[model samples]
Target: MTTSPILVTGGTGTLGGHVVPLLRSCGHDVRILTRHPSTDGVDHVAGDLLTGEGVEAAVAGAATVLHLAGGPKRDDEATRTLVRAASRAGVRHLVYISVVGADRVPLAWMRTKLESERAVAESGIPWTALRAAQFHDLALTMVEKMAKLPVFPVPGGLRLQPVDSREVAARLAELTLGAPSGLVPDLVGPHLYDLAALARPYLRHSGRRRPMLPVRIPGKAGRAYRVGANLSPVGAGAEVGKRTWEEFLAERLG
Candidate 1:
């Protein structure tokens, strides 16, 4: 009997870059649903999850779908589009990667993520969703921009638990290959750090010095962040990734 390929969205991205190889190494035939045509001759299907362009065809014949494609905007709409297509195609398992605090954080992006989670859960298809912390790469990007300024406005009361993307990919791959499970425990880094703690190390590594100006992130969002709404609850049985921010910096910048 021939096995259907596992269709992965955002397979060219950082998390997907790790996941696709992992799935392939485990002897699973993998396919990538991409917006652009493949120039590398891999098993890529041209499709757009937002517009539904070529999405139906891309979902065809694939028993499982790993949905990792998302952005700052229109993520809910895109997920709905994909859900409709996947449902029509009788996809058995749909795996999604989301951020921590999708339900608790009162932000536009978090709203979209929560909506996307609802779409998957209500789609009548077997599904799994994993909420993870911000990746070390994203943390690095944030600190990099802040270190470049003569005076960086450090948002007071803001903290993050940045996990390793590869660890996240490994977990997602496990969930993708297993039977459909509901919402799993959150995944976060080993420790939490304030924005200054994240940025100070970057400054030292890059041979630059900057004045840190502590600034409050006013309004409801600020209030949410001040209370650690973005972090996974302690003793809630959430999984922790092993890599630390310093280790990431040493490997990336050194």
Candidate 2:
């Protein structure tokens, strides 16, 4: 049987970088949607999700689409553009990468993600949405951003399961090859850690000595995190990622 090409939007980003290579290694044809029209290996199609430009051609011959493109600023119009384009292209399967607690999280970014997931489900295409915990790199980035401050004021007692980006990408590649199962298991790291604890190693690596002030954030989002809304349920069949926060810090800091 001829393996159908899988078009991965945001293919140059962290998760898509890992996902595209995995699909290629699995002998599936992989195509990447990028803003640049460069002719690199693994079919590259130039497209812009914001204006819905070049999307139809990007997904023309693909059977599966890993919809990973979204603005960090949470542009709902951009998301609807992509969804409409994907539907018009008649894409068979869509595998969306979402964050944990997106449905109930009070943040605007989380709410935009929830809206995008809903658009995919109602797009008349078989779809699978994989909600994963925050990426370990994102936590490291936060530490780097806050390193210069004398005191790190973090919301205390909030739980986070920071999974590796590579692990999430692997699962996405697998889903591209398998049948669509509406919403798959939430992927998380093997261990759960508090935000302050996760930032300590990062601080040490940067040679910064700062007191961590555990502050209670005043918001519904803070309450949700305190209740472990960012964790996978016991029966969710979550894939356990091997990389730990310590390991990630060691590699990144070294």
Candidate 3:
């Protein structure tokens, strides 16, 4: 008997790019749901999570749905759309990728992440959600843009534990293949780096220097970040991914 394909949303993206291959290697048939169908040699299902178009059809006949599609906004709405369809289609497992500060950070995007998590849990389908730290790729992009400016304004008390996206994909692939485990340990990097610490390596790598201005991020969000609300607690047994910012920079810049 043939197994049903695992439906993956955002399979063309960075995280999904790493995950789909791992699943395929494990002998699982994978179907990728995307807005723009491509002939990239993977099974493609055209669908829009935000608009609910082709979503039901995408979930049809699939026993598992790995939801990685997200954006700066409307993530909660999109998750809800996917959850409803997945529930109706009797999807046995729904695995989601969320951020570490989804509940603690007082930010709009964080709120959306928390809401999305809730939707998955309450959808009645066996679900697994992993809250991961900022990806090194995103951190690199941020530092790259900041270095372009005349002066780099390092936010006061801002810190992050940037994990490797490939490591995250590996973990997600394990969760996707295993039985549902709700709200697993948060995945984070080995060490934490503040704003200046994150930028210095980039500057040295690129042979650029700029005046560093210390700026305070005023408001509840700033306070939350300063207090390390966005981090997994040190003694909380968070799953730490083995990769450093310097290692990432060396590989990326070299």
How does each model score on lDDT? Answer: 0.93, 0.82, 0.95
| lDDT of residue 183 for candidate 1 | 97
Query: Model 1, residue 195: what's the lDDT?
Result: 93
Q: Under the 3 Å rule for N, CA and C atoms, how many clashes does model 1 have?
A: 0
Per-residue lDDT of 19-124 in model 3, one digit per residue for the tens? Answer: 9999999999999999999998788999999999999999999999999999999999999999999999999999999999899999999999999999999999
User: Over the full model, what C-alpha lDDT does candidate 3 score relative to the true structure?
Assistant: 0.95
Top TM-score hit = 3
Model 3, 174: alpha-carbon shift in Å? 0.3
Best by lDDT: 3
Residues 1-254, model 1: lDDT tens digits: 22899999999999999999999988888889998767664589998988889999989999999999989999999999999999999999999999999999899999999999999999999999999999999999988877777798799999999999999999999999999999999999998999989987888899888998999998999999999999998888999999999999999999
Please give the range of 10 consecutive residues that has the lowest summed lDDT in model 2: 70-79
Descending-TM-score candidate ranking: 3, 1, 2
Kindly report which residue pairs in candidate 2 clash with one another: none
Measured on C-alpha atoms, candidate 2 has an lDDT of 0.82
Per-model tally of clashing residue pairs: 0, 0, 0
| Candidate 3 collision pairs | none
Per-residue C-alpha lDDT of model 2 across residues 133-184, encoded as one tens digit per residue: 9898888887787766788878876877888888888888888789989988
